[model samples]
Target: MSSQAEHPKTSSSPVQNSIPASSCPQKRTFSACDLNCKTIENKIRKKIKHSWKRILKVCKEKDISNVGEIPVSDFLDIAGKFNLDLSEGESNQITAKYDSKKNGTFAYYDFLQSCVLFLKPKETSLMKRVIIQKPQKPLSPGPQTTSFFSATLRIQPKILHCWRPMERTFKSHDETRSGLLNVSDFKQVLHDYNIDLAEEDLFNILEYYDKNLTSKISYYDFLQAFIQ
Candidate 1:
């Protein structure tokens, strides 16, 4: 049996930082530039380390906060809780990562959150190394075309519990103006990872609960399964 009282699991894929197009230009890129892709690369690596450590703390304690998205204050709170004395502006890179949440490396944050909320300890090895398509097709000319990254992390079945709701409430107007994710979508995600849970598993979970139980699955239900 697992050592912890809870069986929740989480895993996240790795990511390579993107060079801000405005930041890295051919004519302006000399030897020293703060926003240089190389500089950003180093900053990204450090940020990943810092972010991973903060996230790891929560996973170890089995605390599910931010609904999966780890915020800046939460990062600091976790660091403080563990007595991890990081310097001021220490999380600047991470903050930058989140700031770029809309455009830059946003996929990383999304992918990482899935990892944190759904993976188990035994599955971590699956993400240790992965191949990412380098953005060789440069948008501009310069020394900025040689870097792009990706990695995979597997979530063990032992650490996860997910559910699905019967009906999906969508905004119907825009992708941005969205509603809960349906079970089928969540199942498709699992299918991509080749993680299979028999229909019996779903039925068994719902057999007991009267309110939380549902005849179908929704993104919200899937999330509910984890926190419960």
Candidate 2:
């Protein structure tokens, strides 16, 4: 992992139901929002990393019913300790956006998102510039080798688990429904879904699927690259 204290590199995602579109920065302000997203995400990650153990302890002390999750009240208390200005309205919004289980509590990553909601931006319109095209070439199944078999066995289940969600997630973010995600859109999708990945990681993975160097990746190639 990179130094938590250093600059972060995640992208932005869609506005959740609780946050109105008007609350998101308009397209005119996207460039600045883009830069802020990286810096803010980095800071949030660093703070969370430093205070995670403490947060967990707080959860236990508060007697949260679900381990690794904390209610809004406890979250606000800990957020205050971290010097975050969490308001009741914002806390409710965060819970609505990230409490995936509808449990009125937040998992660690989701909590991180809530803490940095100001950094989340509207989906950048830049992705619209890249035209969606079919995959120029199919991914190779790989050479038949003993190591391949072992690796496949080890990773197959994990891939299956992520595949369906990955597809669904990609579609959700691809508002154009164009069966592809440009680089910006893909990064934003990763950010929206709270996938822990670096900018370099996204680029390298995209390289495998972006055969034409078009900066666009199709659904088939997305599945291939995402699973890796």
Error of 1 at 148 (Å): 19
- Candidate 2 Cα lDDT to native: 0.46
Each model's C-alpha lDDT? 0.33, 0.46
Instruction: Give lDDT tens digits, candidate 1, residues 1-228.
Output: 111121112243212233233222235443443344334444444344436544454633442421223445655566566554555554444334443343332223332333333312122332233221112221121111101111112232222322221212211211332222234443445554455544433322222211233222223323322321
In candidate 1, which residue ranges exceed 4 Å CA deviation?
Answer: 1-70, 82-85, 101-228
Give the TM-score (vs. native) of candidate 2: 0.29
Among these predictions, the greatest lDDT belongs to: 2
Clashes of 1: 13
Which numbered prediction scores highest in TM-score against the true structure?
2
